[model samples]
Target: MKKISSKMIFGILTGIILGITMAAYAVSVPSEQVLYSNSATSETTVNGALTELLNLSQECKSRCPEGYTCTEKKLCKRASTSTLHTETCMTGSACHVQNNYKTYGHGDTITYGNISTTAGTLKAGDAFDCDVNGNGHYESDSERFYYVSTMNNGHMRADSNIAVLAYAKTSNTYRLSSGHISYNNYGNTSYGPQYALNELYNTTQWKNAPEIRSGHITDSSGNILKLNFSYSGYASRLLTYQEVSAGCSIPAQVVSYNSVGVMDSGGPLSYSCNFLLEDSNYSNSSNSVYYIWLESGVDGRNDSAFDIDTYSSNVSYDSVTSMNYARPAIEVPLSDIDY
Candidate 1:
C-alpha cells in the first residue's frame, strides 16, 4: 500500500497542533485595522511572507487578495457572485453559461478559467426531452453542474464546475461514480492520489474542460497552474486546499457533519464521498476501494493515524492502507467549458 513518509507525518502532526493550540486564527477578523497583503491569504503559501498581517473583514479599504474581495469590513473571494449562472434555454437547447472563475485553493490566484454552456432544450416532447421515458427528471442533452466544489460559502464561490453525474471504473474490480476527489491528505504523503483524479478529469463528462496536457489548466489571466499530489495539506478542500493545491488562491471549506445523516457544513464532501464510496447498491461495496486523505490530522492523543472520517460519507476509520483509493479534486470555470 502507498504510505506517507515519517517526516511528512511529523510535519502534519505539527501543523495540526499549531492549528488547534494557536489562539489566533490565520484568517480571523482582528480588532485593529490590519494591513494585509494578497499573499497573506494563501493556502499554498501557508507559511509564506507578509510584511504586515492585515485585519480580515469585509470592510477593508485596501485591495484584498486575488480570489477575495473586501466587503462588509472583511475579505471574501472576488467575483464569486458569478461562479454559477443558471440559464434556462427557452429556445429548445441545453441551458449553459460561460462561467469564468479563479478556482480557490488549488493553485495560482490570477488564472481565471472559463466555462461554456449551450442552453438546455425544452422538455415538452422535443427531440431531446428532459425525460424521453417520462421519468419526470430533465434529461437534457447534457447535465448542468457547478465548476467549483459543492459548499456555497467559502473564500470563493462554489458551483463553479457544470458537471453531470457519470461513472468510471478504477481497477478491474472497482467501479466508482465520476468526479470523485479528496481535498485532504490520506497518509503523510499524497499516497497515489493524482491518477484517479486524472482519470475523472479525462474520462468523465468533464473531459472537454480546459486543461493543459500537463494535467493542469490555465485561466484567462495567464497564470500557470502547477498542481501536485499532496498529503498533509490544509483542510477545507472546497476552496483553501483544492484551490491552492490546484494552483490558485481561493480556499474551499470542507463540509462539516455533526452526525451521519445530519449535515453541519460540508454538503459537497458528503455528495462526492457518498456517491463514490457507497456502492451502486448503497450497501458500502468493498469492491471499489477508497483511500482518502484528510486535512485534519489525528489528535495525536487518540491514535497514530489521521482522522479520515471526513473523507467518506458512510465509512468511518481509525486507519487505512494502499488497497484503498485516494481521489483528488480540481476545478475549471463553467464558462471555460467551451474554452
Candidate 2:
C-alpha cells in the first residue's frame, strides 16, 4: 500500500512475469500430457484384456476349482480311457488259464526201472499207475504144455524120457513156457528156448534116443501107462543135470518113476529113467501117477504101426515101464520157462 522505491517496483514486476511464464510452460509441456494419457490407456488395457476376461468368465462358471483357470494349454486331466490298460481273463498262452481251468499236452517220455508206458497229455502234477505188457509171461497151461510137447516130439525117449509136467504158477511178465522135472537122480532143473532138456537128454550121456511115436503107451497087460506130460510142443531137451538122490520115494514119487519098455520092445522090461519129469502130476501129492496114451503120431501114422512107416510118421512117443531104477529125477522150476 505505500509508494515503493524504483528497484522494489521493478523486482515485483519481474516476480509476476516469472510466475506467469512457469504456469504457461507447465501447461504447454507435451511430455507430461503424453505421460498421463499413456498411464490411463495402460490401466484400461489391463482391465479389458481378452485373456484376463476369459479367465474371470471361466472362474464364474466354475469350470475349474478356485485359483485355477480354464486354459487352452492346460486342460483338465482324467483317468485313461483306453481298453489296453485292462487285464484279460483267459489267454491262449501255453501256461495260461482257459475257462478258468488249466490244460496240458503230451510231455516227454519218462522211464522207471524195468517198466515203461506211453505218456500222454496230463497235468503237471498228475500221477499214474503203470503195468507193462508184451513181456514174456505165462499164457496158459494148455498153451505152454502143448508147445513143449510139440518141440519134444520125436526127440526124447518116450518110455525112458522124463515127461515135462507143468503146473500153473504166476510168473513175471516174461515167463511164458512150461517148466519140467526129471526122474533122473538129479536135482530140480529148468528148460526152455534157452534151457533145452530134450537136447540135453539126447546127448551121449543119456544114451537114449527120442522115439518119434506120438501114441499112448500100454503095459503088457494092455493097461495104459500112467504118464503125466504137458502138451507144450516147444519142449527142449535137458542141457545139464544135477544128481540129487536115488528115485524119489513114494511120498515124492509124483515126478520120479521108472518107465516100462516101449511098445516095440514087447518085453515089458523097465528102463532106468534118469531125467527131469514133467510137473503135470495127477494130484497135489507127489505120489500121484500120470498115464500116457498116444494121441497123435508124427508123419500121420497110426499108433499100431511099428515099422519104419510108423516110426517115420511118429513125431513123438510115450513110453512107460515098471521096476526100472532111474535115479533121482530132475525138476524144472516154473520160474525158468521162457515163452
Candidate 3:
C-alpha cells in the first residue's frame, strides 16, 4: 500500500537465506549420539566424547578411603606399609626349599682297633688296657712294655693265643710291630695286656726273631735265587711256661741282641731263608731282610710283613708300651698299599 524500495527488499531476502543455511549446517553435522552401527563415523565421535569426559572427571575430588589414592588410569589402590616385605615378595616364577644333619654321641667311641678312647676327648694319665689290637694305656713312665695279641676279629680266641710283645719309652712312644699284625688283632684280646713297668733292655730276639725276609741269593753256579726265609732269633726272651701253653713257642736259636732303636721300630722287617745245596746235599742256608721305617715323631712299634709272596699274604704288627698308647695298625699288600 505505501511506496516500495528495491534496496530494502534485497537486504531482507539475503538475511532470510543466511539464516536457513546456518540451520541446515547444524542439523547435518556428525554427533556421538550415533550408535556403532554407523561404523566409521561412530568410532571417531565416540573417542572424542570419551576424552572430554575423562578430563572433566579428573577435575572432581576422588571418592576413595583415607589411605588409598587414585591412579592416573582412574583406579584406586592402598598405599604399601613396608619396603622389606615388598622387596621380598615372591612370584609364581620364583621360590625355593633345603635338607641333612649329623650327630656325635655315646657308642660313637673313636676306636683305633685294640685301643679306644672314651667317647670324649683324651687327656694325660687316663688308664686303658691293650687287648687283642696291641693298643696300650697311656703311662707317664718312659720305659714300659706290653704283650699285645694281634689277630683278626673273625679268628680271635678267648685265650689270647696270638699277640706281639711291644715296648715303648718316653723317647719311643709308638708301636714297633708290623702294621699287618696290629690291624688284624683289633678288638680281639681278652681283658687286654697290662704294661710291665720295667723297660725291655734288649730287642735282640725281636730283630733276629723268626721272620720271613726277602732277598736275592746267588748259588755256586752264579744263578741268583729270589728267596724268603723264616728264621728264629736266639736273642729272644724265653716265654713263661704259661705263655707256652697259650701258644707261645721257644726260640730256635740263642744270641745276644741290642735294644730296639727309634729308627728300627715302625717299618717293614722281612726275613727269607733259602737253602744252598752242594752237589745235592744241603750245606748252608741264607736269610734276606727287608725293612722300612716311618719317620713319625710318635714313639711306638708299627711293623708288617707279607707271606711267601712279597705281593700278597700280608700281616700287620703293632708294639706299644701300653694299651692306651696303641693305635690301629695297618697291613696292606705292597701292590695295594696306599697312604
TM-score of each predicted structure versus truth: 0.27, 0.15, 0.16
lDDT of each: 0.27, 0.22, 0.22
Model 3 segments beyond 4 Å from truth?
A: 1-143, 150-162, 170-339
Candidates arranged by lDDT, highest first: 1, 2, 3
Ranking by TM-score: 1, 3, 2
Per-residue accuracy of model 2 over 1-339 as CA lDDT, tens digit each = 244432242244345446556877566533223211121123223223333445545665556544444443211011111210111222122211122233222231211111112232111111111111122232222212210111122323233223232111111111233322122222111111122222222213312212222332222222333233331332222211111111211111112223652334211100111111222121112322232112222122122211111111111223211111111111222222221
- If both were scored by TM-score, which would come out higher, candidate 1 or candidate 3? 1
- Model 3 vs. true fold: TM: 0.16
* RMSD (Å) per prediction: 25.2, 46.6, 39.3
Residue-wise C-alpha lDDT for candidate 3, range 79-173, written one tens digit per residue:
11221011121222221110011111322311111221333322111122222122222221321222322222211111232332322221122
Compare candidates 1 and 2 on lDDT and give the better one: 1
Model 1 per-residue lDDT tens digits across residues 237-331: 21223322122111133333464633343212322222232122122232334433322222221111222232223223223232333332333
Local error of candidate 2 at 278, Å? Answer: 3.4
